[model samples]
Target: MTDSYDRVAVVTGADSGIGKATAVLLAEHGFDVGITYHEDEEGAWETAALVREAGKAAAVRRHDLTDPVRAAHVVDELAGELGGIGVLVNNAGTGSSEPLLGMDYERWRSVLSVDLDGPFLCAQRAARRMATEGRGGRIVNVTSVHEEYPRVGAGPYCAAKGGLKLLSRVLALELAVYGITVNTVAPGEIATPMTGQEDRVPRAGSRPGYPIPRPGDAREVAAVIAFIASPAASYMTGSSVFVDGGMVTMGPQAAGALQSGDWR
Candidate 1:
């Protein structure tokens, strides 16, 4: 295997939020980025412009993770345009807010397919290419705090993210031989379109329930991803890093201070 990989990265869902920040940060870190968007071609172009502004090459494409088979090919397409992929950030995802009983099979399946199945297929394709080229690579799956903690109304989202965390671990173990590291970055409530907080900056006292007492910024989550994809994290793999502003640590405290059963 090659000792060092190429400085090329493919980030899905780069049109906005964590994906966009990650792509730009990676570009600033001396990587040529391949950006993909679902229905935000304009936003993707904006991200591409920022990448080029950072003095790196940027390639944009439309990637619909709902169609996992076709979407996974976007990896190859970007890799072809960028020479090779040294990093794959599986950041495209969807979520559901209805209770299990209220959700139809279609809703549940849609979340599972995009949040879990899409990453699996995309990782498979990227890993195959990395292995064939004999260059080590990095795979970062952007999950959620729900990956470990359940939410009352997000049954399908939790299930998919939880499954993805385990899948990342297995991939880390299997891909280690090829010098590919797989890890998951689980974030709490961030100011992103997914959280209905797009273009909003998190204030210090915004979330009193959280230990940090505020929503996280997309850039904050992206920083950790950039670190894991860099050579500095060479010894890390199969780990789940939580950029959740201590939200995961507040479960017991929150439960103890609950004033009512209204939480249910």
Candidate 2:
């Protein structure tokens, strides 16, 4: 309420991992933050405490983005609580390890709804508010290296992220006139709670598949997202900033070069 220009960011799935890192980093950069979590209210408050420790205000909420309709409404609710939304990071996502052919219909629908439809709803709702209020916004979708590369058992995740990447570009083109910038951040092999590797930081000898020779930290990816959400990115939109340690560029040759998997 201090100024219409006061920066406020809403990051979904912020209870842990990359989303948590993003909220904390944005706070460090002087943005009031709103964090949403599906079931980990405690983790959400932990993130809030980190934000407060960084000298910024934080609003925490319980959100399930699987419902597109409810997803938009949640954006509206968060905006109301945070004064206005300057940045929206659609980071809530889920993955399926089930094989593509054997995947059930409901399971497939669930993935698409959360990863694609939900972001679409939130983007539409937030962009409308930003354009209408005459305050442009920043939307950074947390996609994956899978947005460009297909994995063995992650067909649904690949499809959803790929769709979101294209959708983000379209939104970037459409929202540019309003001064709103939209972009995608594709991270590869990040060390986050999602990978069940929070206790193990990426070591110099690990992650042989990466050119950098190690998995990235969540903060590493969050830094890229924070930059894109900042005013310095005023002229950049419809872009995909990759934080994949050269994973995607390595191509099939990289996977083919992999010497082993646990089963092997």
Candidate 3:
């Protein structure tokens, strides 16, 4: 496997949440970062500033996963500007709240487009570059605990994440010859804007249903991603690492204890 050795990393949806945290942490780990934001240009710049504070170079770009084909080009653009991509973190994603029966086809497609198609295309771009450069790299896809479990109102989300998990495994097998490692980081409920808990400390709240009983911090998830992107993780690939605070383990127990149909 290739040693990361102060290389470049590209993180999507980096305007906030796990993406932002991962970008900053990677910079601290001797990597220059390329950040992509969907709607928050200011937040992207803020993340860039944090990377700069880490004494590493940072580049910001607007990435719309809805237009995945064109959006994937941003990977090349960032790689060109930052030298080359040594790590590709496919963290940009969208989720759905409507049930399978109530949701329209458009909504389902939207979630799949951003959550699955976008990552596939972005990974393709980054992988091609890595293969050509002849240096091993890392491809970390930020999925959710739903990848292995199910949620009542998140059919599309679960489907997309589940598909991404399998896709990562396939990529891992195919890319092994290139010395590139591919893995998935599956998180549970996180205290981020996406979860309606932006800038809030997870310890301030409580989740009786969860094993850890509180939401996870973005940095906690980022820490794992940083490790997977590092040279230390060279031997690990096609693995799904759970940063879910044991949430996935409590499904049967939590379900058995529910008092009402309110869970539906």
Off by over 4 Å in 3: 4-6
Candidate 1: deviation at residue 11, Å? 0.5
lDDT of 2: 0.88
Provide the overall lDDT of each model, using Cα atoms, as 2-decimal numbers: 0.94, 0.88, 0.93
Residue pairs with backbone atoms closer than 3 Å in model 2 (clashes): none
TM-scores of the candidates in the order shown: 0.98, 0.94, 0.98
Model 3, 1-264: lDDT tens digits are: 878433999999999999999999999999999999999999999999999999999999999999999999999999999999999999999888777988889888999999999999999999999999887899999999989998888998999999999999999999999999999999999999999897556873488777788999999999999999999999999999999878889877987998899878
Candidate 3 least-lDDT 10 residues: 198-207
Best by lDDT: 1
Q: Comparing candidate 2 with candidate 3, which one achieves the higher TM-score?
A: 3
Clashing pairs in 3: none
